[model samples]
Target: MLETIGINPAELAASETLLKLLISTALLITVVVVVRALSARYIRRNVASMELRRRWLVHSRNGLLLFMLLGLIIIWGEELRTLALSVVAIAVAFVVATKELILCVTGSILKAGAGSFNIGDRIQVKDFRGDVIDQSLLATTILEVGPGKLTHQRTGRMIVIPNALFVAEPVINESYTHDYVLHVFTIPFKRTANWQAAQQALLASANEHCASYLAEAKRYLKRLNEYRGLDAPSVEPRITLQMPSAEEVHLVVRIPVLTDRRSSIEQSILSEVFSQQEFSGAKEKALEQEGSAPTG
Candidate 1:
């Protein structure tokens, strides 16, 4: 009859295999259901504590379901292998077509296994910086953090970054400490400006504004260091001078500030430095000198 319908031997064999698989699956499910029911009844009768009885029933049901799954897999293994072998070329093509999707899923798995970052973490991946707002298997959504890293201001934009990038790039967590962090920012000045005075002004401003939490930051860092087995970095405000070009000076200021208040604290320090008499006077003098200098 199969031959009359144009079904070849291979097709007939596959049909038989499928039918057997279905029957076996149904039988396995039925047995699992019976066993689970019996186990639950036994547990209810034998177990005195309600919690323990509930636990036993849950565990038994799970075990039975797992057993049924394994049984189905075993019963269908041969048929599945044959189908896979026949579709080797198709499978290869499918995989090639969905390579990026596969990579995204793999990257998600890697992120989960590594526990790299979580929602609300301020993370930087390659050129992207944002506060993580949502995470899915394929991508992460962030509330954009900056037009530049130093700004510490949200751009009011949402960015979706593919999880695959997490596999390819390192993620920097700016809020790793979750409370306070040592923030660094640069202030550029002309070489002719009173760099010493500017440095003093910046340092004084940093110290004054950051004084309330300096000790706390220090203690927190020390505790973190002990917990993580790392050397504790200083929480004290410090200024390092750098010459980036022939006529420019960069005063790098490092200070400990609360993570959420980074921008406000930085702005306060800048305001105080710019408002200082000595620093402003020096800046004016430098500008006058530049205006008076000979030019071609």
Candidate 2:
């Protein structure tokens, strides 16, 4: 029949093989599309966190890939096993020669498994600090902050660091245990100013901003002490007067607010302190007293 149609038998076999490959590719693509759509509709949307959604998507994708690999084995013939093993061996050798790359991949796996940090967690590794915007098999991306910008505010740059950094570098996950960070700042006033009044004003302002988180902060400290036997640090708004010199007195205020809003919250408290009528009124009264008193 092939001779009559002027088609060679070898050519016909090759064509058949190509057709099978194409069909298998198309089938795999279709399966992926359908699965992704279903997962996005029913699985991803209901997930509470971005990191959880990403995990679900990755699991679905890997499952689809495994299914496709099995399907390809049947489509490509049994003999492809030798070719697959050869390819795998070559890949292993290549990865072995590139030690750093393998370490990065291993780090990614370990970091994800350990759950030390996740996407959307603010972390500092070495000198780089940012929110983890992406974590992949080889790298983790950070939305850059600090070093010429506000410590907690985004600098509008992305820093992609090799995941291998996680293997060796100490990582500070600010939001790992809690969303609020202890924000501390100091304001100095002239010694003659009403430092007591200013300290009261600072406490009031900080408490107004941080009262909501006080309960949880206290509870966390309690549990922390129970678990680790570490002394529980004060988590409430507190003011300490620091006198570096007789001429200058500083009021140090420590308050807890959402980590991302540390700078803004600090600014708010300071603004409130300076704007406090009682604080300002005290200063005015002091000035009047000085003006009326006999000159030294």
Candidate 3:
């Protein structure tokens, strides 16, 4: 092999430069593999903080790859700079072809580092609503829920939202720190229906499911108000009764709805309220029809 390259086998064996370059390359590769394995294992086991673990995993992998490539350049640079420059040129060309993706990746890193959103947050961005499952460089994954016409079954649909939208569009964070939301269920029945009785029953049902949430919400609200530079906030539950139409009485029951139990709590309160309400013969048929439909 050395003869074909116009060098004797002994001469090639004596080349210190070639041997040093080969040794450097091998060490660089070994370092990358060892660091990646240790980092991935540490993140998977010991880190209780999800966001920190994610950041560490990403930066660790990228740092190792970058260092290895830099080492290769330094070790074999005298002979390989031209090759390295060509590789860089090709990478730049590929990035230019995927500019949007590059921006999304950059945005995701910024969002993750700045703590814009985290796993388990119920958020809506770019017209998609779901609980965030995980975030990547270019996109964030969501467990789909609560879009008009979609319900239950986990939806099973994963929405990949470009993180760049975080800068361009507004995000709705429903479960930022507090997991309880105030859910208002309004009941309208003919004037003859027992509106007051229905309201009481609905309120009672809500309390059965979420009475503890009210206290938690109060504490959360106080903290929120203080953080926003406000005075002590109201911690009372408000229920209103009204006659929205001449023939109809309206009962609005406002109660705390746990984040995970929103749909269940809503269904329970609605079912109980409808069961307890009294209606006319014709109105009874309409009530049954409405009951068959789903409520958001």
Candidate 4:
């Protein structure tokens, strides 16, 4: 009859496969529905507790669904295998053609899986440091945070970074503490200047500026450590001396500050330290001497 209608052998085989799959699927669905209904009725009648009845009904429905799924897979196994091979070939070619897009998506998956950072969290990838403002599958948008890290000031520009960079580089999460963070900044002094006095002044300024929230930051860090099973670092203001060159001494200061107030707090500390008579005395003397000198 198919031959009379001009259907070739290959077309006949394909039509038979489709018909068989459809009929088998319908029969499986019908069987599953009957079994589910019967089992639910039996469970309700035989089970004493409501919870047990619910559990049994759920298990029965799930088992029936699984059975139907298995039956369908068996019925269409050969066709599915052929389709899967074609899909694999297409996918390989597509990946090769769009390798960067694939990498960006893969990076997004890695980021989501790792719980790396979220909107409003400050993150640094290579030289790009900013607060994450938006995230998409292919890229992340951030408000650029610095001319350099030490400035801790926004450049008032938005940067869209490809998500693929996350896979290739490390992401530094600066706001891991959420509310507050141990912020570090450096104050460099001339080796010939009153280095000891400058150190004292800087330490005093930090202590004064951070005194209000110092205890609170310590407690917050303690709780975080306890929650994460980590050893807590000291939150008290610290100034460590480092001599990077013969002409300079860097007084590295670390203190706790609200995540959003890092730049302000740093500015306050620097202003307070620099305004002191001890630090400004040399400049004042130089200015007075210049003024007394004959006019050019």
Candidate 5:
């Protein structure tokens, strides 16, 4: 057609090459759209896990991008060798420059694949502890939990953490297979106080408050051992002593509770321990002794 208009041979070749490139790109785009639509429809119909389905869709999109790049190289090979080489060089540099972003996306893929943690799973990475509430390509959002507050209550803050941190930090899946958490807290007393009695009182309180947890834990652990042969330790209520100083003794109570009910469970335990006659009687005795002493 160009020859009929008296165009030169070199210009004609360039035009033909450009036309081929356009056709290749158009075909690649069409294939991408059709494949995604079909895959999405199939996944939505057949796949059960929402996370797994989303991951499959994401993988398909990434595969399409790679296919488009490869198709471009094949379409423009011989005559456009210099252009392709330049494009490859630029792509390599871009990938290197955006390494963190690539890592985050890669981390998201790995997270989905490994079933590391899911929405509502209680997890701790580094100093951040919370329940995962949202996940995206770049970051994960968590309903923040405590250190500054008692009862393991949420700080009423949402934390947005980069997904790439999953690779960089140790991920602690606290409530992975089970929907329960080990709520551990310490009740301190003076060294002269009846610390052994306090320990007993706390243990009794935990056992009372964790009635359902203890039952569920027994069933959960039995299944785990029977199926996976996990040589797991006892999940029964326990009280361990920690002496921060010679003057201070802490009775640490460790017991299981539903993950979302951490604060309430802690409150219940605390209330029970404090309400115990031994605790209040000890406090009144201490006050009386202090009062009877010289005012020097």
Candidate 6:
């Protein structure tokens, strides 16, 4: 072919490698553009689940681009097989140097894919405990909250945990399977106040704020009862009054709400139950009488 084109065979061979490289480069560029365009269009039209769409793009791009690039290299030069072997060697060295980081990243992906934890779930893994804020390739982020309520104790701090810890430790998610979280608050009562009335008021407050979720919860309870041949208690909310301390009765108010809203629900239930005129009247009279007497 070179002789017919009035080109020397040596010159043709010299330029052949360069021509192949250029063609391969152009093909790579075309693949990138076309893939990106198609991805954008598909996303626009399908509007699929966010998590599913992201996985789709990542796996598709990695497989397609990697196949094309390797195919081009192999076609251009059989010597490229040696290059692939060298690249594998470098990858092994990297694995050794950043073993922990690599492991964490792998764990994060596996945990997320397995639906072990998700954003908004209250999770306690190893020593770190909080509601998940975000998840990334390398780390999982959380807004630190305590056990009592969904109070953001680490107000400004965002926890970044490497994914590998999931494999090393057990993950406890209080809100993973359950849609509603229960928060218990204790309010003190005077030895003289009507304890039963206080209990009733507290239970009423819990029901007022969280009655919506009770029906579904009761249905689940009903199903469990049928399976076990047991009688499940009524789904209506209840408050337990206990006297752990000598001077006061402990009104244990349990209210149900989403995990992140636990604190707010607690506060609302407390305020409403304690603020009623019927409940506060005697306490107010006692306080007024005490204040009127001078403590000299």
lDDT of each: 0.84, 0.77, 0.72, 0.85, 0.77, 0.70
lDDT of 6 by residue, 1-296 (tens): 76888989887786887787778778787877797779867865696676556555555655565667676766666656656676997888888999998898779667867788765677888778886766666678887766434343445557888888887788887774355555556777776666667787777778888777777766765776687688865656667778877877877766656655667777777678667735534665677789999887
Instruction: Give all candidate RMSDs, comma-separated.
Output: 10.2, 6.3, 8.5, 11.8, 5.6, 7.6
Per-residue lDDT tens digits for candidate 5, residues 74-96, read: 77677577766669878889899
| Window of ten residues with lowest summed lDDT in model 1 | 50-59
lDDT of 1 by residue, 1-296 (tens): 76788879898787887787789888888888888888888999999976456556655765676687689779988877878988999999999999999999889889879988766779999889998876766888899989987789999999999999988899899988877888999988887667788898788888899888899999998998899899999789999989999988899999999988989999999888887655434766778889999999
In angstroms, give how far residue 251 of model 4 lies from its true place: 0.4
Off by over 4 Å in 5: 6-84, 109-114, 147-151, 225-228, 276-296
Displacement of the residue 179 alpha carbon in candidate 5, Å: 2.0
- After superposition, the stretches of candidate 6 with alpha carbons farther than 4 Å from their true spots are 1-93, 126-133, 143-157, 182-197, 220-235, 240-252, 258-261, 277-296
Ranking by TM-score: 1, 5, 4, 2, 3, 6
Reference-based TM-score of each model: 0.69, 0.63, 0.61, 0.67, 0.69, 0.56
- Cα distance off (Å), candidate 1, residue 115: 3.0
TM-score of 2: 0.63
Q: Which should have the higher lDDT, number 4 or number 6? A: 4
Query: Against the correct fold, how does model 3 do in TM-score?
Result: 0.61
Name the TM-score of candidate 1.
0.69
Instruction: Give the lDDT of residue 59 in candidate 2.
Output: 58
Q: Which pairs clash (backbone N, Cα, C closer than 3 Å) in model 3?
A: none
lDDT of 4: 0.85
Estimate, for each residue in 234-261, the C-alpha lDDT of model 2 and write its tens digit: 7889999898997888888888777568
